[model samples]
Target: MKIGLYFGTFNPIHVGHLTLANHIAEHSNLDQVWFVVTPQSPFKKKSSLLDNHQRLEMVYRATKDYDKLRPSDIEFGLNQPNYTIDTLTYLHEKFPNHEFALIMGEDNLKSFHKWKNYEIILENHYIYVYPRLTKVKTASQFKDHPKIFNISAPIMGLSSTFIRQEIKAGKNIRPMLPEHVWEYLDEMNFYK
Candidate 1:
């Protein structure tokens, strides 16, 4: 089976996320896309992050209905400051039968070289990159990288940061998330 690993904090999974996951699953040869909820990204700030379990639950609620979209808490039990290379290695060892690929935005590609053991990641795995503002599609930029491939997803200006800001400002997020997830967020009072 071909599995696409879409790793993110997913503070609150929104339609944009679902759209992208659906796009990848529908257009690509991948069998499923797992949203690997990272406990703490090495390059991002943790101060604003919600608890790992809570984030995982939100992801679960957001993706439960989609057979092709699964929520994964594999990184929750791992050490702090989770790195992509380590997680990929762990998943590869644990699920040897499944072919794993990385799904990320073009924004990440610019700084991917700075990641720990980035060379190994680029050499061994296939990357399905989505387009993003500020990171124009450039074949020359990744000519040296053998596994990188650009994918175009529906354009969405929405983001978790925007959702958080909306919640904090006393604005409703009902439109930003799926109905169940919106209800769950309200019940749990997340980001408030």
Candidate 2:
């Protein structure tokens, strides 16, 4: 099985997240795009992040209906300050037969070298990068890189930060989130 691991904190899963995963599954050779919910990200601050369980539960509710896309808590059991290389290594070790591909954004592509054991990650697995419009224009930086394949996913620019802010401000966040997730957030009063 060819699985594309879409790693994210998913402070709360949004439509943009699901849309990109679905697009990747349809456009690429990947059979499944697993939304790997990381407990901690090396590059991101944890202060603003929602609890892992809350985030994971939201992700599960958001993706329950999709067959090609699913939520994963693989990094929860692993040590903190979780790095991409380590998670990828663990996934490969556990599922020897399945080919694991790393799903990332253009933003991450620019800072790939800063990751731990980046060389190993590049050499061992395929990196599927989706466009994330930013002033830096890092997408072109690795346009034809051997290990990285640029795939065309939606460019909504929807971010979890914006979603959280809207929720806290009592703005309608239904547009950004899936119906179930919006309902879940409404019921739990998440980020309010």
lDDT of 1: 0.86
Summarize candidate 1's per-residue lDDT along 89-188 as a digit string, tens digits.
Answer: 8898899999889998887777777899988887888999898756554546475566887787876789999999999999977988988889888998
Q: For residues 1-192, write the lDDT of model 2, one tens digit per residue.
A: 999999888888899999999999999999999998878655576676878888899889988888888889999999877778888878889998999999988888888877899878888899998887683466453667797888878886899999989888889889889999989888988888
Instruction: Supply every candidate's count of residue pairs whose N, Cα or C atoms clash at under 3 angstroms.
Output: 0, 0
- The per-prediction CA RMSD against the true structure, in angstroms, equals 2.2, 2.3
Q: Runs in model 1 with CA error above 4 Å? A: 41-46, 137-141, 144-146
Model 2 worst lDDT run, 10 consecutive residues? 133-142
- For model 1, what is the error of residue 189's alpha carbon versus the real structure, in angstroms, after optimal superposition? 1.3
Off by over 4 Å in 2: 40-46, 135-141
